[model samples]
Target: MYELKTKETDDSVIEFIERVENLKKREDAYRLLDIFTETTGHEAKMWGPSIIGFGSYHYVYKTGHEGEAPLVGFSPRKAKISLYFATGDPEREQLLESFGKHTSGKACVYINKVLDIDVEVLKDLIRQSVTFLQELYPKEQR
Candidate 1:
């Protein structure tokens, strides 16, 4: 059996943000924490040692792999801030067109800082991911 390495932990999100060596990244982490909290209407939680996450969902793939993951999250990394959103959603791609300067991976959108992207677009991404995941895995079922 494969283990999920990024399970949510009872770590202090503020302490994690405070430990960020870069002053700018540290400030942006606080900004992102507020944005994610207000947008998702859920308190932020630490995923693994790094990720600041909000609102979790249970996912089960057809291959029988299943686990809980944040509906949306972000990590203020050394290189760039990584935004986590639901993959395989066409609407996400559509919204990203106006999301300002950023790069995308399989599941993460990387931006240098919060100022580098549109906050409204980021909120949209958060809401869309939360809705998509909630619908996919209804609360009762989870």
Candidate 2:
């Protein structure tokens, strides 16, 4: 498995969010931080240089590729807020259909504003994604 340094939760993530160009977007980023931490019971951590991630999981594909990724995360990108999580199983696609006013890019869901989506629905999406991943690769493997 490819090894990555275990990420530590830090206040720098909040500082980074504060630096977002749009005030409303910055607030939305912080709100996502709160929801992710509260629901996942994992503090926010800066991933690489930009992504604000919560919890983590280690993954090794059958092809022998491996890496560690956040259990759930988001970034306030210049174009839109990019939400991150596993997109596995059929039910996840069902949730995405009802997720509202958002675009999916690869594995990340791009939303312009948190106000554009249902907060509770977003929470359920995150919860289900995390649970689905856990079933495939438990926390102990992370």
Candidate 3:
């Protein structure tokens, strides 16, 4: 039984943002908070100690491993902000072409700040992530 380390908690999202040491990152965190919330239509929740997540869904793999995860989220890290989105969406790569300056991994996109990326593309990414997850885990209610 593997445990999910990033389970959602009752931690204060605002306090977490306030603790970000960098002034610009702190401000970007606030802006991202608004973007994710408005785009997903879900209030932010603290996932683990750092991730500010907007919505959630449960997933079970073919091997029987299962856990809950946010539909979209972001963290203002020491080096850069990490944006979480659903993986395996081909459209994500297409959108990133015009997303301004950002780097991405399988499930996370890294950006210096909100100003460095196109906010409209960010919103589309958020929406696409939520839609992709919901479709994949259709029975799990958010």
Q: Give the top-scoring candidate (lDDT).
A: 1
In candidate 1, what residue range of length 10 has the lowest lDDT sum? 133-142
Backbone Cα, N, C clashes tallied per candidate: 0, 0, 0
Per-residue error (Å), model 1, residue 39 = 0.5
Which residue ranges in model 1 land beyond 4 Å of their true spot? none
lDDT of 3 by residue, 54-138 (tens): 8889888888788888999999999999999999989899989999999998878999978899999999999988999899998
Tell me the TM-score of each prediction against the true structure.
0.97, 0.88, 0.96
Against the reference, the lDDT scores of all candidates come to 0.94, 0.84, 0.92
Across 17-61, the per-residue lDDT of candidate 2 in tens digits comes to 889989899889888988899989988898877889887788778
Among these predicted structures, which one has the highest TM-score? 1
Range of the 10 consecutive residues with the lowest summed lDDT in candidate 3: 133-142
- lDDT of each residue in 1-142, candidate 1, tens digit only: 7999999999999999999999999999999999999999999999999999998998889998999999999999999999999998899999999999999999999999899899999999999999998998888875
TM-score of 3: 0.96
Clashing pairs in 2: none
